[model samples]
Target: MTADTAVLPTLLTALRLPSIARNWKRIAEIADRDDWPAARLLATLLEIEVADRTSRRIQRHRDQSGLPAGKTFATFDFNVATGVRKNHLLALGTGDGWIETGDNLLIFGESGTGKSHAVAAIGDALIDAGRRVLFTRTTDMVQRLQSARRDLALAATLDKLDKYDLIILDDLSYVRKDQAETSVLFELISHRYERHSIAITANQPFSAWGDVFPDPAMTVASIDRLVHHATIIEMNGESYRKRVAVARVKGKDSASDN
Candidate 1:
């Protein structure tokens, strides 16, 4: 029995995280009496369980290019736990319990209304619940689609969107998409419409989607499908970055006086 073999049982009990505890063998190998850095790093890494969980999330979205590393709705103020529900904003978007039933959703708000964060949090929750999720910016997705097309895998790539439980397109309208890209995007949205779920964070309103897709008909079709069984969440607030900047400035001034 090696030293790790001896403490494996106890270490498992320490964190009470069975999934992480399973890594005891490796953790023990690097945990030497003098290697505090290595030991602490390993411990902290496993303790968060992010190492294990994030991989699963990434794998799920690898097909659809799902959620970001650790985004979730729980991190924001409008969490369902204590959020104010105003379907008026999302009325056109929400389609009969879709939000609660893993259907599509769209969050359109000006800079810093917590729109992206809220949806990201939801994506995180989906991951935690063992649901497939992928998060990417519109520009990133279009680029990815373009790459897949070059490899002659565009159809395969769009189909993958159906595999994911949820997909989040963050910051749409960053740039215009060509006809082919818009076609693939439309297919992707149509595939997820009423079938899977999607959450989009856009700085620009839907009225301006035409700028992204020069084809007027395609844009309307895509939006129609996306909003059909979806919920639209509109948030209007000051920039979060600006608020943080103000707070930091106040702290600096206070320090100078002391």
Candidate 2:
């Protein structure tokens, strides 16, 4: 109740102890009620602050990652993605220092085969583990990079992307063979080579990548850099979306017959 006590929160705010500043009053009351020692009270306050800060940091990163909030490993139907190995993905989800070493992940599958969902789930897991990530469709990211080039700020844009530990480029097959866009996309791939991690989902295999990049040589170069230290996951299975649609139609037909 003293004037000095009123200024305590202000001091905590200035020191960037936001959690402690907001909850110290209530926590102090609980500590006093339990007759806790000074050390215990201080430790409890710090623990609260650390937990709150960690939660907030994860939330911020997740928000900035551009990943779908509902797309997580828990919701992913592994049975449909039979080609995906659970243990391998679990290991990668830990963000186990592999990104720091600049390893890449190549997810290959046909349309509706859950390639995008799989990589997004991994990105979500990485975000939960305190690693930065960005999720963008292949065309969208390439266009942004292309715009950056026209504005003569491509390097600055790439530098901004470097802030992320991993960049999830969803649907690599969607990027057209536009020389400008493909060049920027290749630049991004080349720039991140052996320096950062990339999780790419593609419908076509490496041999058919010529459709994505106008120049055959650039396509080869991009593929080489991406697969140098990469984990290749082949998800070539029946499309889960098609399977579900077929099941739904069957159920409707059965109901009509009944």
Against the hidden true structure, what lDDT does model 1 obtain? 0.67
Candidate 2 regions exceeding 4 Å error are 179-181
lDDT of 1 by residue, 116-169 (tens): 667766666555455666788877787788788889997888786666667778
Best by TM-score: 2
- How big is the RMSD of model 2? 1.6
lDDT of 2 by residue, 1-258 (tens): 989888998899899999998889998899889999999999999999999999999999999999977888898888778688877887888878588898999999899988888888899999888899999988899889989999999999999999999999998887779546678888999999999999999888888889898788999899999989999999977888899999999999999999
- Model 1 misplaced regions, further than 4 Å: 1-70, 78-102, 178-180
Model 2, C-alpha of 28: deviation from truth (Å): 1.4
Candidate 2 at residue 253, lDDT? 100
The alpha-carbon RMSD values of the candidates against the true structure, listed in the order shown, are: 9.9, 1.6
